[model samples]
Target: MNSPWYIGDPSPSKDESLVYAHGTIMVISWMLLASTGILFARYGRHLRISGRRKLLGDTIWFQLHRFILCMVTVATLLGFFLILIKEKGQWVSVAKDGGHIFAHSVLGAIIVCCALLQAWLALFRCNTDSSFRQIFNWLHRSMGYLAFFLSIPTIFLIVTESKVLPMQQDGLIAILSLWSAWIVIVVILFEIVEYRDRLNSKMGIYRVAQNELMDQTTSLRRKMDHNDGANIRSLNEVKLFLFLLHIIVAISLTIPLVVIIWRQN
Candidate 1:
């Protein structure tokens, strides 16, 4: 009798089950949850809802980002221990297996460390008005970006290189590849939007100078005020659209990968 989840064995052995559980947890915690958290922190600043609510003296975006990241830290720790226990606490020797395992292990360790460090930094960050606040922000952003960059390859190694549970390698690879491309495209779109905003601001300043020289300051001021309001609204709409699109796409891509992992033999 074939079980819906376990194709070859209705009852997988303990180690195999551990591997499956670890993989699924990681996919959800990092790929889905962490990605959403990071995206919200980056692109959700201008969102109307962000400032409308507060928790723990922080806005919605900050609260959501912090909560999700804290959950990722816990989930990551759990996944790490599960694998370590499966190996009986024996560290993978890079010398013996100087391949994907080595890369994955090193990268995974760094990512985990970054996660812990980020949580610690967030907890003890200086107040917004403090002079040291900028330093804290820089350190936090740097570590986060580093962890995010490393996790991509580490996750690829998990699906393609793990030995305990057999996976559909080609399918997973294709999915990850497309997902990576999607992330890159979304980031580029954001950059383009930011650039456009800066360019418009410069042009507006130039127009102000020209209007003043032509003794048209009053009319120009009225027109500029109206345009500024419209632009703010348009910018907000664009950002909100992107944020929602990202969430939808992230879930869409994550679901297939998770389902594949769950149903793997």
Candidate 2:
């Protein structure tokens, strides 16, 4: 008789193990991406309006975030393959019963789309010239909505599939899923609120600075206007600080995810 735990002779059902590991990694990657989004939407937006220079830490964090995103993309692809190859046998049962597999497939598709949008935004749209800033911003905003929509299915998959896992069936996965969902919601809401406030404040600042520059343009023609220079310098400084803060936030959010994955394994 074939052992349930051992799916086939000399093979101890690596599917489950792969699924678990890939799931955990995906969770971490998602959290990091969400954290980066929060920072960019909130603090980074403010910095852009204020015209701040980039700081060292900010540069490092941006690069690190990009690197992690790439890794996550690869991992997600691997997960797709693992599910397709290893779980082929169970697909029929999963599909016929309309259980976690359905939710997983839906969520997986959403995730893939969001990930692609993110990549496009980060690599192509974001680097466009100022003339296309509005277009880029619109794309970025749409991607954010897509990410939010994707999160719902992902949460469903996590909660529903956790019950089927042998070692992870003790409510740990459900609890974690709930906790992560809460965190994502809180962060998104907080950033939205902050974004509105920053927009208002930055517009006010820009108007005042522009007026001051206009007043000085006549007297300081063809030369560096002191007040305008000061405003530009101040904006650059704000950008630098915002960049550093974003990195700090990303690192802080990643720590808990790493810990959870370690504990789970």
Instruction: Indicate which candidate wins on lDDT.
Output: 1
Model 2 regions lying over 4 Å from their true place: 1-15, 46-52, 55-68, 88-97, 121-123, 126-133, 166-170, 177-265
**TM-scores for all candidates?**
0.83, 0.57
**Model 2 poorest ten-residue lDDT run:** 1-10
How far residue 175's Cα lies from its native spot in candidate 1, in Å, is 0.7
Evaluated with TM-score, which candidate comes out highest? Answer: 1
lDDT tens digits, residue span 1-265, model 2: 1222122224443334555555566655565555454445544433432343344545433444456566666666666666555555444234353456566666776777767777767777545467888988787667656664575566445445533332334454555565566556555654555565566567657866776767655555434445545554565465565555545654564565445434442
Instruction: Assess candidate 1 and give its lDDT.
Output: 0.76
lDDT of 1 by residue, 170-245 (tens): 7888888988998898898877777767777787789777776776757768988798768866776787788788
Candidate 2: C-alpha lDDT: 0.54
Error of 1 at 198 (Å): 2.5
Report how far residue 190 has shifted in candidate 1, in Å: 0.9
